[model samples]
Target chain A: MSKRVALEASHACCEAVRMADTDVVAAYPITPQTHVPERLAEMVADGELDAEYIPVESEHSAMSACCGASAVGARAFTTTAGVGLELMHEVVYIASSMRYPIVMVICNRALSAPLSVWCDHSDVMSVRDTGWIQVFCQNNQEAFDMTLWAFRVGEDPKVLFPVMVHFDGFTLSHVTEAMFLPEQEEVDRFLPKKRQYQFALDPDKPMTHGAFGPPDMYTESKISQEVAFRKSKELIIQGWKEFGKIFGRYYYPVEPYRAEGAKTMLLMMGSLNETAKLVVDRKREKGESVGLINLRLWRPFPFEELRQAVKDAETIVVFDRCISFGGPGGPVFSEVRSALYGMERMPKVVGFVGGLGGRDVPIKDIEYAFDRGREVAEKGSEEIFETVGVRGKVEGIREPKGVYLPAK
Target chain B: MATKARKTKAAVKKLRTASEVTWRDMEVGGILTDAGSAALRRTGDWRSERPILDKEKCNKCGLCWLYCPDAAVDACEDGYYEVNLYSCKGCGICAEICPKEAITMIEEEEE
Candidate 1:
């Protein structure tokens, strides 16, 4: 038989991870995330699961242990946040380049200067280029669902890269939601036994993994990697489609919240989009035309899908939680702008960077985003601008609004 | 609750111990150093051990590369062992087999 229980989002994610049947889990303890591995430890102790749990010293060693275990043909799992993610940064690249299917959970938190362990995209944004397929979970249910799916998607032979599931720190990590725990047998049916890993070990079969690729072959290797990433989007969709078939839930690359009409729109990722959705709802109730685009896929960025979503809107507002610093707006915001660059009827995009280090971006402030959008659509504005949050000069910056994208 | 756990554990322990004919063999079980080179010299596990001359030591003899089982020693910009950490596996074949004796199979420093 199976069971259902009320647990925090972190615990819900762990429950699915428990059901996913990892063979080996190597992780070091870090906050807001400690509960996750702690529960797994209890599961192992009770003999509820047969697995090897290796607890190492630091995040680097944690990932090092993960690489070592994954190398020898075991399904590995780990979780971390903020500086823990930073410490594992070097090995993150190795995991992806080597194409070992290690899955991790990043309970999103802000990096510290004076020390903060609160919700922010700064940590996840910093490591986006490490080439791991990253996914944002809107709530605890998605957190639980995506954690199981990440393993399935990541371990697919076509997409053998590691994956990171990001959920807002303290906010979602501590926030509880009613999640439907699937039967373990269903998960077993969904994710079958892994193909025997051909890692380097057997004397009979000598093999080389992660040997330095020379310049002559390195370019082609990267092209193949990009091709794999393109292949991953289809794999991600297939994983989701299969998941929806079993669990009665569906997901899209760019989950359009309410962009049916509305001349103006807001594009954002993570839970902030939830806040943006409520703002759009209240505005719609007042007979206003405003919508939201909650992007689910960041890397293997769904550029073509996003452009098609926004082509009809007259004005676009992108609320970025992490800034690109010295570049055109935030990283995702810049990508969205470039994706629309060639479109003949691209919306006048206004980029706003806010919610750094877990600052509040009230729904009222989101209204200001629409107000700015109205200014652009009405005045034919070219001011590419940013929003100043509750914190000012000392802790916040309101970037100027204008078009920095190359002309369409 | 015990469920005869002790007996199984002791049996497992005994089985594990019995499998190892030599404790020393178990210690060196996973770590292979010189065996890599001997294996590559598939010609009856016997090849003329050639000495590699570290460029700084050699008068540009080009000797070992000429008399090598394989063209394994590659010259880099600065003098350093381009030991293909892959195939070479620190076999000491290049170093022990080096005429200069500059190549010694010191145990690889644990990274």
Candidate 2:
């Protein structure tokens, strides 16, 4: 039996980590990700959870320590947000390429420049190509459930890649929500005590990991990694199915919310999906054909599921929390567009970048997005993307500002 | 202990050169299961210069053997040090470290 309790999303993640029986917790303190490791440290100190908690000075060392622990066949875990993730950018790739199976919780926060410790997808988007199995959590319950699922899927003999469970900072991480916490015995049954890491660092069977590969071997090595990564999707779905059987809460790569027979759809990821769902409900009540598609899995992207979900919709308004600077719209929008390309019948993808740096996305902004998206789909706009609720006017400068010419 | 040594030797024997192996042949995470597998990789082809030994001027101090980074220098039965061309990378460390100045680095003619 599972107990229902109100917990801050960060603490909920800690509880899941505790139940997972992680061997090592190595992380640096970064907001709003600080509460997760902080609570885990207290649990370790109280002897409630027996694990080695290494309070590293930097996020780079934190991830490096996780690599070491995972290499030695330890179930390692870590948490970071925004700039802390950028600080450990290089090691993040190392953790995946080495197939460490280290689980991480990213409290998604905006990047620096303006310097805000708030919720956004900027941090998570930067590490999109790091080769980790990435997933987004819509609420505290999903956050807790996915952390456990991460360990199970990642540590499976078939899929040894690292996993990153991302939730919006402050919005999901700091907010208190009622979630069901499963019993220890139930979690143990789901994720067995024995871990099968074939290439673990053991003295009895000596082996070399992370060997230098010259040009002759580098491409083949990457091809092997890619093959394994693509194959992990099957096990990921299996893990979720098994978890649902035990926990009664099922999850999917691309989840639909009242998307049946709708002409216009709203696509979103992370905590904002709940708000979008509410908007979808209100639109449906008004006899408007609106639906919501929540992208749960980010890496090993749910391309087939996403296409299937939006196949009937005439237009898809992709609301991205992070911008791609000068590139085509947002990162999610560009990928979604590319995924829908070459199809016989494809919907118009209207991208909007908003809710940046913890800015509140009011119900009216979402409503405007739907209206604007419909209008844009009917009559095309010259702009690549439009910012939602931004208060500014721009003057166009078509020519170069400064130029230097060599003497003739 | 004997079985373990034999198992490692068997793994080493089964190991294929980089050009011969495909992605499917690679171990999980590209881990090399056999220990001391580096000894099987011949790095001697990287050499542009070869080390030559002057036997009469050599003091047989074993400095070349000690200083050779690749362990390419070997001691003969007659106490003379000879460079093993199969493993030498032409780093010239043996020539640089010899006190008697009996070792010389000569540029190799293109094959």
Candidate 3:
């Protein structure tokens, strides 16, 4: 039996992790994520979840420890944000390359500047190429479900890669919502005990691991990893299908809202999906043909799904939480445009950078993206692919100077 | 058993003993170049900068030289990885991937 409560989303996520029964939890506490490891620690102390909780000093150590634990065949969980993730950047590659199913929940927050702790996608974006499968959640309920589902997804032998469940810090992390918390038995029955360590260091097996592959074999090694990752997309679809069977909640890489008849759509990731949905509904009431498309999965990016979602639509307004300075376009927008480059009727994608410091991007502003999408359809083309919001004209279109981390 | 494993390690470390293995000496007998690369930049150097180990860390791992597609790195001793620099174009991938982080890339500082 489960109970529904107006609980904090972070707590709900931690509860799902506890219910999923991860074998190992290693993390260094940071804002928004503090509630997660803190809750797990309490559960561990109370014997609610039988797991080894390693209190590491830094996110790098935290990931390294998780790698060691996961490598040895333990289901590992960790959480961090912003610079913590930046520090763990290299190990993140190691975790994925080694094919250790280390599940991580990131409270999506801004990378420090003017030292902002607010919600943004910058932290997750900075580690985008770290080779982990990334997922974004809209609200508390989805956050809970995805956190639990991440373990099943990552630990799938076919998709042995780390999964990061990202929710907007302060926005969804601090916000209280009535979430349906499931029974431990239900979660256990739904998600199996991580099968025999998919890749194990067994004396009997005596296979070499972490050994340098000769150039003759290096390309093969990389091709194998790439091939394995490409193949995992089907595993993701099957996993989602099974999760829906058990949890009664469905998920998609790109989820469409009121896109049935809408000619233009406002697309975003993370918590802004809800805001965009509300704005889209309001516009639709007045007979405006606007819709919202939420990009749930990033890595093994649902390119085909995204193309299918906006193929018929005349325009797509992409809200990129993090900006790729001096690039052709925003990272999300660039990818969306590239994905549809082969489409018969490709939606014109316009990029927007808003709610940067975790500041609230009002529903009205989402409406603005739709408004710009309409304008672009009528205009020749959007000269600046980036949508400049009500705040200020996009300034200093150059790299923000900072000290380089000496470590590679 | 431990001693046997140690001896096996010693035997594997034999490839790095050569003082120098130069590009001129390389036969290029075996490596099949990709047809695409061959068509695009037929004369292009695909080799990256790899460490030509001076027998210091040659534990006879055979990983470096065995793994060197262009025969850039070789093994001299048991469990050691060495680089043959004549063909190495300074890719630094060996440095990044070394399990022991034994390989280091010292960029030639410009004056």
Candidate 4:
């Protein structure tokens, strides 16, 4: 039987890791993400969980340690935040290429220039091409559910890729919310006690992992990994179906809310989707044809499901928490546009950058997004994306003409 | 080292070389299931200069075998250390380390 309890999102993630019966945990302390490993350490010390808790000096070492643990066929897990994720950026690629089924929960935070410890998608966006299977969480329940699901999905023999579970830093990580906690027996049944690793380091049967690939073999090796990664999407969907069958909580790659016959839709990811859903509800009450699309899966980008969800809508307002610098709006916005580029009857996709670095996104801001999105669809705008709720005039800060020479 | 060499020989017989395999045939994660598969690569073709051993001047001290980075120097049954040209990259470390000056590197002419 599953029991309901209030838990911080970080602690909820740790509880799922415990239930997964992870063999090893190697993590460094970082804000918002610190509570996860801290709680796991306490669980280890109290003999509640039998796992090796490695208190690594830095995020680099933490990920490296996980690679080593996972190489030896151990069920390894880790957690990190903004800067920590950046520090371990290179190793993140190695984990996936080597096909280690290590699970990590990223307490998503803003990248630093002004050094703010807040919630945003900047950290996750940077590692978008790192080859790890990534999923975003909208609330505490999803955080717990996805962390557990990550292990089962990643460790499957058919899909031995690393997984990253992302949840907003202070907004979701620090907030307490009620969630269903399943018994260990049910979890054990879902994820078997014996892990079947196709390749592992063993003295009895010697095998080489991460071997030097010569120029002749490098391209073929990369192509094989690419094909395998793309094929893992089928297994990901199947894993979710099985989890839903047992747990009674179904999850989809792109989940929709009140999207039936809607002409306008708001597409978003992470914890902000919860707030956006409420805004959608209020809009619907006022006889507005508004709907919400929550992007749960980030990688293996769910291009098909996204297209299907917005087929009926006339315009999609994509709210991105991070900017793509000078590029065409945010990363999500660019990909969404690219996906809908050649479609026969595509909807007008408007990009908006907001809620950056822990900035509170009030109801008025989301309402403004809908109004502005429809306006842009009707009368096209010159700007690539509009900033939501930003103070001061952005038009005044123009580049000084002839001061900086143009490249030849 | 001897057991690993034997295992490599056995694995080489059963497995196809990496170049002969396509992306569909490659193992998951590109992990080489057989240990010491590097021996099957035959890197000797990379050699611009080949090491020549003088059997008359050789002391059979085995220093050439000990210093060969690629483990290309093979100790024969008669106790003479000979360079196995198939695996030698011709770095000439064996010639440089030979205490008796029994080895010399000669530039190979294109066939």
Candidate 5:
């Protein structure tokens, strides 16, 4: 029988790791993500989980230790947020490109200039190209579920690449919610005991890891890495399906809520999906043609799944908490547009950057953004980028008062 | 300097050149087969200059062998030390360390 417990999302992650019997937990402290390692350390100290808890000095050292541990055929794990993730940026690439199968939990936080430690997607967006399998969680239960699933997906013989499971900083990490914690025996049955790596850094059979490739072989080396990552999608599906069979809670790469036959849809990620689901329900009650699409899989992007979900919709209002600065619209909006390209019929994609630097994007703001997107689609407007719920007005701003204008 | 060449042979592993490598040989995750296999790679092409030896002035002090960074210097049966041109980087370290002043660094002649 599964144990029902009320746990903060961060602590739930630690519980999941403990249940999975992770071999190593290496991490440094940062806001919103600190509770995870703290609980993990307590578990290791109290003899609850027999694992090496490496209390690293910096996030860089944490990731490096994870790389070393995973390379030596151990199941390594770590957690970080915002600046800490940025500090470990270089090693993040090394971990994935080397295919270490290190699992990481990221408490997504806003980046600093004014230095606010709050919930946002800037941190994970910054490292999107690092080649790690990245996923987002909407609530505490999903956070707990994904943490276990990450280990299974990453350590599969076919997919030896690293995996990162992200949940919003204070939004999910600090909030307490009821979750079903599976028994250790159940987890052990679901996740394999044998740790299989493409190349083990074992003493008996000596091998080189992260070897320096000359210009002659660098391109081919990257091509091989890409092919391996693309192929991992099959194993990811199989792993999740197997987890569902045991746990009774299934998950999808691109999960849709009330999206059937809706003319207009709101697309977002992380905890905002829960808020958007509420707004979708309210809109439906009022007989509005609106729905919601939660993008759970960010890397090894579910392009085909996403295209199928939004095919019938007339407009897609993509809410991006992170900005692309000088480029087109927001980061998630760019991906959605790119995914819709070459399709016979595509929805009019509109971008709304909001909730930056920990600002609250209330349900009303989301409704307004959706209405604006519907208006834009009806008008057939070429300009489709806007920022939701900004305080003061800017000079010479048009219809949607806070449209993000790229510097001329 | 005369030592018996051992009957038990260690196999010589050659590092594949760019053209010699096939896509199938490229391992996933870029993990290499052998750790520290640089010894299999001949770095002779990195050299711009070659060391010329004056055998008459060579004192057989073995200073060149002691200082050869690439370990290209070998003790000859005739008491003099010779450079294995295939692996010599021609860094001039052997010439710099030679007390007999028998070694000279000269531009490598094109074959």
Candidate 6:
């Protein structure tokens, strides 16, 4: 029997890492993400978990160490938040390109200006093109569950790319929740000892890694990497199915909630999906033709599944916690729109950017967004992207005297 | 028992271009089977100026051998060291480092 315990979600993730029998945990603690490494350190100190717990100097070194560890066939893991993710941005690209199966849990936090350490999807969006498989979690249970699943999927021989498991900082990271922590024996059975890399760094077999490819070979190198990543989606589905069979909890790349026979659907990722689901339920109760599409998989972008999820809908309102600045819409919205671009009966996609810098995107704001999206769809508006929950109208906000603005 | 693995030397004699590369040359995780494949590339082709050795004036002090970055200077059957045009990049480091003034940089004749 599995143990049922109430624990902080961050600790739950740490427990998952322990139960997964991760060989190395190298990370520098950032707020909301600190509890994970902190508990891992305690577990290592108490001799409960036998692993190399490297307290790295910075996020860059943390990721670099993980790259090194994973390259040597160790089941490496790490956790970071906000600026830490940005600091390790360069290594993030290398890790995926080199095909290191390092599992990372990012307690997704808002990026800084007026620095805020709170929940948002901004950090992960910044590295959206890093080629690592990214997954967002809705609650503590999912965070814990995905931590285990990440190692299984990432370490699969067919898919050797790194994986990022994103859970909302503060919201899911700090909140205590009751969930069943799987037994060590079950977890061991589910995830056998990590198999050795076919071309691992070994003294006996000398080989070079991360070599410079000239112009002639660079294109093929990139094509090969992308083909491997795209093909990993099949292995990801397979891995999830295998996990479901053992654990009795199923998950999908894009999960639909009351989306069938609905005209307008709300799309969201991370913990915000829970909030959107509530509004979907409320709207359904009042006979409103509204539903929700929760994006569980963020990378390999789930292009086909996303299109299939909203195929029946007339309007799709995508809630983005991070804006794309000069682009057509938020990151999620841009990807969603691009995914549905060539369809014969494409849904009117509305991009709504809110909950930035950790601001609470209340249930009312989401309801308003759905209604406004429906109105925009009915009107056939050319402009479909807008910001929500931003304070007081900006009629007279000006750039500094020295800063020149380009004439629009 | 840490012996280094070596591929057939005859295969390293000629430089192979990207078009000559086949899928069989590709490895699972970018592994380089032949560790120092740079030797397979005739970097002497990149040389604008070649180093001409005056064997009579050469003292065989071995300074040129020490200074050659690519280790292109091979010790002859006699005491003198000769440049192997197959691998020499003609960096002029050997000419600059030769105390006996036995090496001269001249325009490389293209085939």
Which one wins on DockQ? 2
Model 5: docking quality category? medium
lDDT of 6 by residue, A109-218 (tens): 98887798987888998999999999999999899899999999998888998999999999889999888888788788889776567877888877688876766666
RMSD of each: 13.3, 4.2, 11.0, 3.2, 4.1, 4.2
lDDT of each: 0.72, 0.89, 0.74, 0.89, 0.86, 0.85
- The value of fnat for model 2 is 0.80
Tell me how far the alpha carbon of residue A207 in candidate 5 is from the true structure, in angstroms, after superposition: 2.1
TM-score of each: 0.76, 0.92, 0.77, 0.93, 0.91, 0.90
Give the lDDT ranking, best first: 2, 4, 5, 6, 3, 1
lDDT by residue for model 5 (B44-82), tens? 756789898899999988888878887778776677777
Backbone clash pairs for candidate 4 read: none
Error of 4 at A138 (Å): 0.3
What TM-score would chain A of each candidate receive against the reference chain A? 0.91, 0.96, 0.93, 0.96, 0.95, 0.95
Candidate 6 per-residue C-alpha lDDT over B21-91 given as tens digits, one digit per residue, 9 for 90 to 100? 65445554555656666556554656788888898899868888777888777676566777777578778
Clashes of each: 15, 0, 32, 0, 0, 0
Higher-ranked by TM-score: 2 or 5: 2
lDDT tens digits, residue span A117-166, model 5: 99888998899999999999999999999999999999887788899999
DockQ of each: 0.03, 0.71, 0.04, 0.67, 0.62, 0.44
TM-score of 2: 0.92
| Residue A237 in candidate 3, Cα distance off native in Å | 1.1
**Candidate 6 residue pairs in clash (backbone atoms < 3 Å):** none
For model 1, residues A82-144, the per-residue Cα lDDT tens digits are 889999999988888777788999888878875877777888888988778988988888888
Q: Please name the candidate that would achieve the greatest lDDT relative to the true structure.
A: 2
Tell me model 6's lDDT, rounded to 2 decimals: 0.85
Per-residue lDDT over B1-111 for candidate 2, one digit per residue giving the tens place of the 0 to 100 score: 011111223444565656687888878887888987766654576689999999999987889888888767767767787776756899998889889999999998833
Model 3 CA deviation exceeding 4 Å by range:
A203-206, A380-383, A388-390, A395-408, B1-111
